[model samples]
Target chain A: MAFFEAKNITKFFGGLAAVNGVNFRVEQGQTYGLIGPNGSGKTTIFNLINGYFPLTTGEIYFGGRKISGLKTYRICQEGIGRTFQVVKPLKRMTVLDNVVASAFLRTRSKREAVRLAEETIAFCGLTAHKDKLAKSLPIASRKRLEITRALATKPKLLLLDETAAGLNPSEVDEAIRLIRKINESGITIIIVEHIMKVIMTISDRILAINHGMVIAEGTPAEVASNHEVVAAYLGEDYDAQS
Target chain B: MKQYSGAILLLAVMLVFPLAVQDAYYQHLMILVLLWVAIGSGWNLISGYAGQVLFGAAAFFGVGAYTAALLSHKLGISAWWGLPLGAVITFALALPFGWVCFRLRGPYFALATLALNEIFRHIATIWESLTEGMVGILVMQTFVSKVPYYYIALGIAVASVLTVEIVVRSRWGYYFVSIREDQDAAESLGIDTLRYKSVALCLSSCMIGLAGALYTNYMGFIDPRVVFSLHDVSIAAILVGIIGGVGTVSGPAVGAFIMVAVMEIFRSGGFGFLGKLSSATGSPFVATLTKYISEAHVLSFGLLVIFVILYLPNGVVGDWPILKKKLLFWRRQATV
Candidate 1:
């Protein structure tokens, strides 16, 4: 059985299908990539799976338990943590406070939460700016904080929404390495990113969606050469080495 | 270190107030100060930190007061028992109101809560058989001293400040702050913004309700007019919170202290300044000037609110660090 599966997941906004009958699965100890053009419903899929929005139709199974309509916080408590497409740090709070807040959901004691937050902050390379408010951080650091905040929830299956969108090439490389480290730490990761290089580099398997439907699914090499995947990329050759 | 010192100093002052002020009138004034501080701080919890402006504070306060009064007068239950009972009832009542208002944000929530205050006041007045109507309930205490009442009021105020501090530090507190910053962002992070909002409103109502119980016991009276005027307690709390700084923990306390002290001073002898000028000059218009004291307070409150929002958007306490930096900069400039 897959560790996380969304079977026949459908979401609509006033008769317009944002995500139309999508079925996908991620196994434990796997790294998957969700690549789609703008408006292809990648973030919407993330939203539906995490309970951010109610599904028009479908069931989501996490660790083999159906959890489609449960409250978002409860889903996080159940170890299905997620980051946002747009980084949403608690703008007024310090970096330490931002992480500590999410840590509270996992641990009851403030002391334990603080210790965990401190560790996560150092791990994310935000130790130097720990005392600064989240809004004061640069965009890349803000995105890192968002990831750390989600990780503090101790999720079994972590969904990262465009975590490498705004990073430079070197930063993208670092993020890819960090994401691999996260998965290596025993947390399965499904990353949705538009950066083709980072996506191909980090993903063991790639699922490409277009117009609210999956166009192709295969290994990075196969998906790179697949005619339909190339057509979805508007005929630009995807250099597998890039 | 500095924050702790300020807090300790304030606590010491409160502890010594009863002993320092022997006059019954002044002691009564001090009690009112403590009472308003609790109510304002409670209002800050929802409006300041959570960014949900509620105008139903008077309604919760009135319910608590009437609950305590009814329990004491009708069933002979002690005022102490009624305090927690009132808080629970108000918190329960807050749930439905929260459910309705949770769907409304910002100004709409404020208007809905203001409407609730009027609705509750009317219900209290019309429910004559139970609430004693507009005639109100009076409790001639079994004890003679007002010192016990003083201590209880002070204790509740301190507890309110501590509770707000703790909740702001907790995980739920972060959810509240996130909701305040951006609801959509909070939801995207898998935080249930509505549930956190409802929890904030419920907790805020409970604290305000407890303040109501204290007020009724201390004043020995319960009336819809006195207990349920949103313009009296609700507006005062919002204004104090704004003037002190909205979301900061100590903002409401500082705002409440300054507002009450100024109003009390004006009420006691500042109006008499015009009276003295009238007697000395035999001017009819001079006597008319003192009548404007209350109106002047209202005007001052309005002006202060505008100034704070426009210039000191963080409230006085939130701006302290900036002010200190600027002062240090100016001092270095002068020395050079």
Candidate 2:
């Protein structure tokens, strides 16, 4: 049984298929990458897997249990944690409280929740700003807070959507390091990133999609070398450039 | 220590207030202020902390008041028992009302609550068989003295404040705040936004309802207009919440005092201070001005709300720091 699988997932927004008939599986502990052009339904697929939206024509399973119909929060309790493409922090709350609220999902004790929040915040290099308001944090910290908040939920499978989107080179490198650490901690990671450096360096296997359909699925090098993936990204001049 | 001292002082003052001041009118004002505290605290729970922007506080309050009135009129039960019973009946009103209205967010929810206030008022008025129509149900006062009633109101007000403080400190409070900040983010993080919202509404409604029951017992009279009034009950509740500091626990207590004082002062021509001045001066103009001011009390209340919105938008407690800074800056300029 797959650790996570989306079978024949399709979604429509008034006769337009935002995501169509996409099926994929993630093995336990696998670091999977998803890449596509803008508006190619990358985040839409993330939303479906996490149960943010009901699947129009498919089923999603976690540990072989059908989960496509569950609410987003229920899926989180079932051990699937996710970060938003656009970071959503509890703005008025302290950064520590933001993580503690999610950590409460697993533990009933406030002390335990606090412990988990502090540990996760420290891991994200946010210890110094623990008491600061989430809104007052810088963008890089806000993005990291989103990931840390998701991590505190203690999920078996983690979905990170554009976690490294707006960072500079140094911050992106740091984000890549943090993501690798998360992946190595025995959690299955499915990441959606437009940063080529991030996608190429982190993913053990990469899946390329165009118009919500998988165009190529293989090792990072294999997916990068595929003609369809290249054409979708660089246009017909890709072969001419080579 | 400093944080608790003010509360302790307030507790001491309230405990000795009735004994210190034997004036029935002053005691009556205190009871009204305390009742507003309970109602405003409830309103703050949903509208302020939970971010629901409720406009139908009277719905819960009226339901609670009617529950007490009905229990006595129909079942021959003590109106005192209606205190707890009122909350239970309010839950009946809130469960369905929250389930329906929480589905609508922002200003739409506000409009829905206003509509509900009207609906409840009409139901109480038109359901003459059970409610006894416009004649209104009258309950006998349990005591001839105002002291016992003041203490009862104080106890409930204290209970409500403690409840709010505890809830705000607990995990449920955080959930309410998260829903307020961003419902989508809250849901994605595994919080049931609707369920938490309903929980907030239930707490708020029951508290407001409890206040209504207390009001019926104290006033010994009930009418749809008096209990379910849009301006007097609903808007007054909102004003208390906002003036006290919408998101803070202690805010409504302070706000309640200011609100009552304003209402009383304007309604009685500065509590008859203006009347004294007018007569002492022996001027027709001063006498006429005093009468007009008393007559325009409601307008004065409206103008006060407008100023609070323009200047202290976050209320006294929430914007205390800004208020302090402005004050200090002016003082510094004077010193220079």
Candidate with top DockQ is 2
Clashing pairs in 2: none
- Per-residue error at B123 for model 2, in Å? 0.6
Which digits, one per residue and each the tens of the lDDT, describe model 1 over residues B156-242? 889989989989977788888878887766664557788889999888998899999888888888799989987788788887788
The docking category that best describes candidate 1 is: acceptable
Query: DockQ of candidate 2?
Result: 0.76
Interface RMSD of each: 2.3, 0.9
Query: Candidate 2 residues B1-336, lDDT tens each?
Result: 897898999899999999999999999999999999999999999988999988999999999998888889899999988899999989878988888878898999999999999999999999999998788999888899999999999999999999999998788888898888888888888888888999999999989999999999999999999999999999999999888788999889988998999988999998899999999999999999999999998898889888888899999888889989999999999999
- Chain B vs. true chain B: TM-score for each candidate? 0.89, 0.97
Q: Best TM-score goes to which candidate? A: 2
Per-residue alpha-carbon lDDT of candidate 1 for residues A54-166, written as tens digits (9 for 90 to 100): 99998999998989999877788788888887888889889888888787776778899899999988877789989999999998889899889888878888999999988
Residue pairs in candidate 1 whose N, alpha carbon or C atoms collide under 3 angstroms: B245-B315
Evaluate every candidate with DockQ and list the scores. Answer: 0.41, 0.76
